[model samples]
Target chain A: MGIIDKVRKVSETVWEIPVTYKEGMRAPARIIATEKLVREITAVMDFQSAASRQWMWA
Target chain B: MDVGVGGVISPGGIGFDINCGMRLVITNLTSDDVRPYLKEIVDLLFQRVPAGVGSHGFLKISRQEFREVVEQGARWCVEHDYGWEEDLELTEESGCISGADAAKISERAIDRGYNQIGTLGGGNHYLEVQVARPEDVRDKELAAKFGITIPNQIVVMFHCGSRGFGHQVATDYLQIFLKVMESKYGIKVLDRELACAPFESPEGRDYFAAMKCGLNMSFANRQVILHRIREVFSEVFGRSAEDLGMRMIYDVAHNTAKLEKHTVDGKEKRLLVHRKGATRAFGPGQEEVAAPYRDIGQPVIIGGSMETGSYLLVGTSSGDQTFFSTAHGSGRTMSRTKARKLWHGKQLQRDLEARGIYIRSTSWAGLAEEAGAAYKDIDEVIEATELAGISKPVVRFTPIGNVKG
Candidate 1:
């Protein structure tokens, strides 16, 4: 499922992904962003996380 | 979300450039007064403030003094006559986060940081001269209160950080954290970069103290840069910085994790807020808000890409939802590499100069990478922040001169 589908809107600008989305999750991840910014922030975050993984074990 | 005393501290959370931040200085000169010397001013600033990769500063201090600088922060700069005493009053945390231990910083970090004070690093970092147009005043009362008086009032804004010193600090800690995160703490993560140690753990505490040194180093760096700016302007205008009304509006850090008191579940809790790519927008009446702005709110300087413009905003009482935080800047929508490929630095410089914005940079590649088009619409970002009630825009600053790194 997509991140937007996983996150439940908390407010007009805030979104939260429940801990149940992934195993070993301690708490929900709260993001403060507009609908448009969500795309930008998530895209960069995904790229960074993937690159971080490669750097970590390389 | 109570980190309480047992929260985990992630070096990744704060990023590599420990206290990458912004500082805005207001001046009494109007745009017309500065327009005549815009090129000269930008040229002198480009000369005085070292920029680009591996840039060293003019400050000459031994290892012992550098140790004291990290420990004392901007206060050391003030004591040494680099800035006015009032500058600290307007700075967040009085320009120094307490509990920074010099000994916590590695020698490698010291070697990198010792001479980097007052230097601007490359990649989206810049020293800009902006004008607060009369038409751009959103809140006239608040704008006047923040020192942006008169039409087309000139102000200097710069974005920089702890330089190589902070990078070394992060590198040193990231290596240590990676080793102990899983073996010592048994804390596994989705990504290895999420490596963290308990707040009270020896590694965590040491990193926290070391990070504060990075914070202080950045603060001191900006303070000295301000000093250079004041000198450059004084020479060009033949007036003292004070006589020219060069008062600092505020200085804020973008990458940091701080232990702060907040209301969670209607109960007071100490949370370790990791504000990466975010800024603290403490509301009015918060004790942490500077005294001059206590009746209003903390001045949040949202720096836009040099091509467009930036904004001066005030925190809102309604900012409690996201732990009283807001976006740091019009974040990059395009990668630096992608941007460099799309635009040439020299061409971009000529394009900006044609649009009435003076520009100078160490490299055209760096300049092109920071082309305004590469970032999100700053107006839209500010609108989002205001609509979300995190911060209220007071005035917008249009750049007339910029020294890009």
Candidate 2:
């Protein structure tokens, strides 16, 4: 699965990426950003691969 | 939010103000003494001390002198006769934080800071002439030790920071890390805006060094402003500031990251502690607390809005668990936009004057955004911190005259 597919919403303005969605993960990572901001956030974040994915957490 | 080891240092962690913090000075003169010339004193201070966004400062120094300001911090101002030598001793880190490398700072940062020294940048920063009451004196000896001899002891308190210099430094480093974080280090971030490098990485070391310059710049900035306050008082009172017994109580910075030694699990460890809105409140007997104040603990200044009052607090032993830190100011209860929507600046200014609070601000809209009601009650915040055993209250100062940016 793509990194974006692993994203989940925990609350408004907060998103979580579950540990099970990725290898060698111990805990989920959370951020203070909305789903819409997720794409805008990646223009610089996805330096290793060219990718885009959108998943509805709500 | 804890950033892990080798994690990047985001400019957002400390914000643009850098070492933006508060400085409190206690005077021998009483409210009665100043009230007669209160208007004149405030007016002169408002003129002598520059406020507002992007305002130029009084001192016009050479580029070499400017570099010294960053390298020597507050000491640069004192050596140049800006403030008394005693003022330096009372200030944390003696106004100079080691590890500051002016060479590490970007040229753009230099340009922004060169003419902006000694200024109170816009957005809620202020210099106020206040009166402390005896009724609110939490510890009489502590207050006395702090040079507050009586109720109505006229005091001057101001809040400011590194100004545009720090803003430029944060911007420069953030951009640098954004480019190198994933490419060179293979680091993945939770937020794109939260770009950072390892604390020991080449990028991290350079940023840290640059950050120290920003801290020192803030120290020098406040030291110069304090000197101006003394000058204004000396002129208004017809005596030297020293003759008036006007001396600095203390100065504290609320932002920045410091590598400090702390005891954990009964073992001493050094950790990089970053406090954005919190300040060092080292309790009594701690070596880091200033010399004269070592027995009493570090001074914790909690600045409130114009209408509300501010407090002077001392660190306590019980606060060690939280790295001996406490709140820096009366936390905002309403956002700036919300407060502006609630009231007009002109009306708020008139209302504050009616209540005996004199205000001189660069912009009325800026003043409205800083409405006292928009902040958490300072008295209550102090009370809670005291009850929580993090800090002990020293004195409560109500503003009589204010100058804001």
Candidate 3:
């Protein structure tokens, strides 16, 4: 699945990424944040190339 | 809470100054009585009380006598007529904690503590004049119980510590603990600032004793300052301290370690309680609380930055969960260097004067370090603690004047 498809919606302000989706994962990734806050938070991250690489792998 | 030998030094454990603390005193005078000479009174205090970094008090003593002051705490001050015997009852640990061995304290610590007995050191150390809130005045039952009655009754609140003495003690032990950490005890540390040994170890015992000496030294220092304050009031107003009703409310230490029994996991256990940047907020009926304040619980004095409002809170039973602890003051929001860089001392003083808050300080840089804007909203922090069931607010006090060190 694509990176976006792998992200599971948990609540209005929360999201979860399953550990099984990654090979070296130790625990599920949990993010507690509003959509706007998440967008602002992600804007500071270097995620474009990583997301493209993940999509290519899928 | 357990610091097995070789733990890293965490700032949260020892804090900036090892035993920085606060003391609250309630007076019977009404606001109107003090209002007329508020400026003069603050001026007199600034003149009579030694302040700023490395300030020395009027009294001088031999190293042996100074060691006795550290060993006996406020009791030594009381014996020397700096304060009354009744004041001891209101202080935590009755003003003196056992195990203050002069031998455990270093010569450098002794030298630093000698002349600083009644001095108010720099940084956040301050003396303030405050009036109880109207709501507290209306609650006659509670007011009567806490000795706070009559609207606009003046109270004195100050925060200080053992000065250079406490710093040296913490410094000396931090080095000693660091040396023993790798060689004697193979313990890894996450932070060097949190350096500590096991509670039962010899090194731990020595540090604890020295720490108690620092605690005692602070109490005695404040006790002496209280006497000087009384003398200043008498000189300015032509009335004795008793005539002015300058009675001590309570004195509590913020940074120190003590062996306390608390219920953990549904079982009672003795734990070494280290309250760094925190105060004990024991609930009502706790034997540790003073007799008169037992029903109301221990008084928790939360001093705000000079420009903000301070608060008087009471401990609740819920505090048992956190070893009866609460935040000591409004936590700093900005670094001191940042505050000093952002604001000028003269401009800050002018702003405070505009709000009718009189201020006197020894150093302009010290004043900048304590700018109210440098701290978090005290009201919000107190609310958070109340919501978390650690303490309950009793009354809010807005500062009319302040003396900074």
Top candidate (lDDT): 1
* TM-score (all chains, Cα) for each model: 0.95, 0.86, 0.85
Kindly report which residue pairs in candidate 1 clash with one another.
Answer: none
Q: Is candidate 1 or candidate 3 better by TM-score?
A: 1
lDDT of every predicted structure (CA atoms): 0.88, 0.81, 0.78
Candidate no. 2 TM-score: 0.86
Give the top-scoring candidate (DockQ).
1
Angstrom error of the Cα, residue A37, model 1: value is 2.9
Candidate 2's residue-wise lDDT over B200-235, tens digit each? 789988998999999999999999999999999999
Please provide, for model 1 over B1-405, each residue's C-alpha lDDT reduced to its tens digit, 9 standing for 90 to 100. 246656888888888888899999999999999999999999999999999889999999998999999989999999999999999998888998999999998898999989899999898789999999999999999998988878999999999999999999888998999999889988888776677889888999999999999999999999999999999999999998889999999999888889899888888998888877678999999998999999899999999999889999999999998788888889888998999999998998899999999999999898989999899889988987898899999999999999988
RMSD versus native structure for model 3: 8.0
Off by over 4 Å in 1: A5-7, A18-25, A42-58
Q: What's the C-alpha lDDT at position B146 in model 3?
A: 64
TM-score of 1: 0.95
- Please provide, for model 3 over B33-87, each residue's C-alpha lDDT reduced to its tens digit, 9 standing for 90 to 100: 8888999999989987789869999888999999999999999999999998999
Better of 2 and 3 by lDDT: 2
Q: Which lDDT value does model 2 have at B316?
A: 97
- Per residue, candidate 1 scores C-alpha lDDT tens digits across A1-58 of 3556776887777777677765656667776667787666666555553433222110
Candidate maximizing TM-score: 1
